[model samples]
Target: MKRLRYIALGVMVALLAWGYVAFNHWQREMIFMPSRAVGHTPPNGSFSDQWIDAPAAGGVEGGKVHAWWLPAASPEAPALLYLHGNADTLSTNVAAIDRLRQAGFAVLAIDYRGFGASAALLPEERSAYADARAAWQRLEQLAPRAVKRLAYGHSLGGAIAVELAATTPRVDGVVVEGSFTSVVDVAKSTEFDWMPLSLVVSQRFASDEKVAALKTPKLFIHCARDEVIPLRFGDRLYEQAGEPKSRLVIPGGDHNDCPAAAAGEWRDTLRRFGGISA
Candidate 1:
């Protein structure tokens, strides 16, 4: 009877171990979805490609992050580090960068490793944060004479922007659109809510916790009719963030079209938030 009990215990332990491993892999797949297929680059030589050399957490700078440098109408204008979402690359965000540039801000849209033309490796939370830091350094180096240094992140990039603002010291402002509080919070709003996902999600971007403690000036934007990330997630983050913060509710805007839907409002908010004249 004792031998049979021991065998049963061993089998249960093995099964649990296998389940944990499998669950983590699934979470990784669900979190970081990268694509090598780039959609398009800017036309008319509007921007230039700038490759940055920065090491990811627990990973080497095998190749480098590819960035699109869109300078403002002037060299002394504010500079923005454009951290894109998991599935986005520099090619997909030309209009986004252009919008900021038109507002008199130099935008550096970066492609993290494993995404566009960057190094091909699976991106984790820490690695993405590392890439943001690298991009920040490069942005500073490239635009040393800029008056302000800001960060703008969309979707998953929003979490990365929050992380960058929390860790960096010289950041002037931060803007996050269609962002979630955390991966767990997002999962809870989905069909997988019943599963115990928080335990296995190693790439958790806990922006809720980090944003609450950050003192930087922040602007949170959410699409009221967002189909990808619920409006509640961005709302929750806005509520959780401390003082020196504001929010914009994009009425009738979806995941990717908020700026176009509210172009005047968006640019006006940027001018006010970043103290820009353009």
Candidate 2:
């Protein structure tokens, strides 16, 4: 069976090559360049904000990270600490910020390390968690009298928000949109199954693992036709989370349009969850 032996050897070599390439990709992803943060340079604008710098998570060697603080329409409004997706800058999230502001809440959106005005560094799950904590601490110092603080994250940002909510009791409510259950789950479903992501995904966002531990009210929004992160991931996350959670599914909406499509519904949903009157 010499031919059979050769085939087996070839398969083993192919698998090895795949594993190596996947690992390299993972390493590169860990070091992905952070996008430049865009903002409205305004003397006659919708809103004005100031940037604040703080230490990067995990004690990484770098200057302090950066975040933006946009005051609410009024001082009595609640505040939102927002985390953006992998490729997004704070200005990219201005629409949602506007929405939340219309709903009467101040917003603080921060770029992760290596992103926008923040320091450059490889992003890891724990690192993002630490950065989130730093943002809250900075906000407390900036606005001492603020009553409520909420967390809203989309895609990769959702993973960040979930980790913070599960571990930190100070978060009043959490909104995770277009999030996945885990990186492995996503890899397994994609063409990258040959990568063995389940084995090497070190910074596993592992949203499912922490969902049950979250005690605060959570709102999970997903698009039924989402092609980037399948709707099933959100479904799985929902099934794993504890009480005081709600899932909103937008039919026929893809990943990017979910917010726009469900704008009214999103406002209503967050209002109910945050106990804010519309």
Question: Local error of candidate 1 at 111, Å?
Answer: 0.8
Off by over 4 Å in 2: 1-25, 28-33, 37-49, 56-59
Cα lDDT tens digits for candidate 1, 216-243: 9999988899999989888889999998
Clashes of each: 0, 4
Best model per lDDT: 1
Model 1 gets an lDDT of 0.85
lDDT, candidate 2, at 250: 86
Each candidate's lDDT (Cα)? 0.85, 0.76
Q: Write the per-residue lDDT of candidate 2 for residues 51-151, one digit (tens) a residue.
A: 55545544454445566676765665678888878777766676666677677677777877667767666665666777787787776665555567789
Off by over 4 Å in 1: 1-21, 58-63
User: Cα lDDT for residue 144, model 2?
Assistant: 59
